[model samples]
Target: MTQRTPLHPVHLELGARMVDFGGWDMPLAYGSQIEEHHAVRRDAGMFDVSHMCVVDLHGAAVRDLLSRLLANDVGRLKVPGKALYSCMLREDGGVIDDLIAYFIEEGWFRLVVNAGTAVKDLEWIGRHAAQAGVKVAPRRDLAMIAVQGPNARARVVSQMPAVYQERVLALAPFFGVAGGELFVARTGYTGEDGFEVMLPAVQAPTFWLALKAAGVAPCGLGARDTLRLEAGMNLYGNDMDEGVGPLESGLGWTVVLDGERDFIGREALVEQKRRGGLRRLVGLVLEDRGVLRAHQRVLAGEAGEGEITSGGWSPTMERSIALARVPAGTGDRVQVDLRGRLVSARVVKPPFVRHGQVLVNV
Candidate 1:
């Protein structure tokens, strides 16, 4: 059976085109995907992200458990409500999953992981939690709603109680605050200022309705994908999987290797760095009038060949963009094998657009 989020019926009532996404029935688009994408860039839009899993870690050894589990160091998050983005790795240096961890207090931390990988991530975390004397609790009773874009914060604040409005609206980026049953975070997948609110599942419908009343457009997965891609954010199972490591996935910055605190896959990553000859992730922009799709072969001239891990028409840029894994020596120009016809493309850094502005030389 396909799983349904708490807002499934709401989506249907709003005329959303639903589709199976990673075993969950999710809305692909409510109306025009391009319009929804633009709404998030130009105004405010809200997405039902209730399918994502939230887990809480508790116990005296919670910090130690996280230090061993994630690539990024939790020690950096000294302030309460501070969040860190990191990837959990396998013993062989392969990525298990990328998640956001929030430090709530001394012995408590919250983690929001991908919906598709929630089960496996929990299993992996459970196995390690036992050894570290920590307890992992999945919070399935919570529903997440992400209100994103420049006007997103103001719109969300309009619904909040006046007493909490100041603190909630003043939240620092990548930080979260828990007020009663609601947990609001200043984080979003789209490259925009926003808030991801987590509240009781029963209250989701009411809160969602209130958001709509606040003039926030209802966006779907189609717009969400385009927005994240434009932000240079990686989607699990698309940009990376268990077969890829952080160093090659353009996520080396998330790994901490300075201290003696060794995490899983540290040895393998160290070896990979020393051995060299690694493929690297890069951004690509099509120069011609053609749409880009995943699995397209890229001819990197003297630097050998590569493959697109994730590719699509960027609605914000009004062109085709992609994330490709190429040989480290690949140059700024390459040819993409699109349906037996080779087309020239320009190699650039990721993040084709951010904060409603074009960042690359497209």
Candidate 2:
């Protein structure tokens, strides 16, 4: 059976186009996907991300368990509500999943993971937590709503209850705050500034209606994909999987390999680093009239060949863009095999757009 979010009725009432996303019936679009994409870039937009699971870790061994499980060190998250992005790795250095860990309080931590991998992630976490003597509890009673754009913070804060009004408005980026039953985080996948609010599932409809009344447009997964791509963010199962490590996925920054901290995949990562031959992830832009789609072969003349991991038409840049894993020697120019023709593309650093400004040279 397909699972419906607390806001399913609300989505149906709004005439949203529904689709199956990792077994959950999710909204793909409200009307025009491109228009909805633009709404998030230029103004404010909201998404029902309740399908993403929130798992809480408790007990004295919580930090120790995380230290051994994740690629990034959790010891860095000292201050309460500080969020750290990390990749959980297998013993062989393959990425199991990417997640956000929030230090809520001593002996308590919060983790938000991708919806598709929630079940496996929980199983993996539980297996390790058992050894560490920690408790892993999934917070199924909560729903998450992400309001993103330049005006996102202001709109969401204004609609929040007075008790949380002051604290939420004062939150810093990459931080989260908890008041009563609500947890508001100043974090988002979209490059634009925003807040991801987690509240009791029953209150979701009321809050969604409040945000809609405040002029926040309801966006779906269609827009969310394009927005995150333009932001140079990685989508699990597309950009990476259990076969790939962070080193080759443009996510080496999230891996903490220093010091005596021995985390999962640390030894494998060290061995891979010493081996030296690895494909590199790069951003590609097609200036000519064409769309770049995933799995397309990329040719770098005599340099080498690679494949596009994630590709799409960026609504913000108004052009075709992609994240491709090509030869380490691949230069600033490459050709994407589109259909039967090899199309030219310029390689540039990612974050194609941020805060309504195009970062790469178009």
Tens digits of lDDT, candidate 2, 226-287: 99999999999999999999999999999998899999899999999999988888899996
Can you give the TM-score per candidate against the true fold? 0.99, 0.99
Report the lDDT tens digits of candidate 1 across residue range 108-222.
9999999999999999999999988899999999999999999999999999878889999879999999888789999999999999999999999888999998899999999
RMSD (CA, Å), candidate 2 to true, equals 0.8
- Candidate 1 colliding pairs: none
lDDT of 2: 0.94
TM-score, candidate number 1: 0.99
Q: For each candidate, what is the lDDT?
A: 0.94, 0.94
Least lDDT summed over 10 consecutive residues: which range in candidate 1?
Answer: 161-170
lDDT of 2 at 152: 95
Tell me the lDDT of model 2 at 172. 90
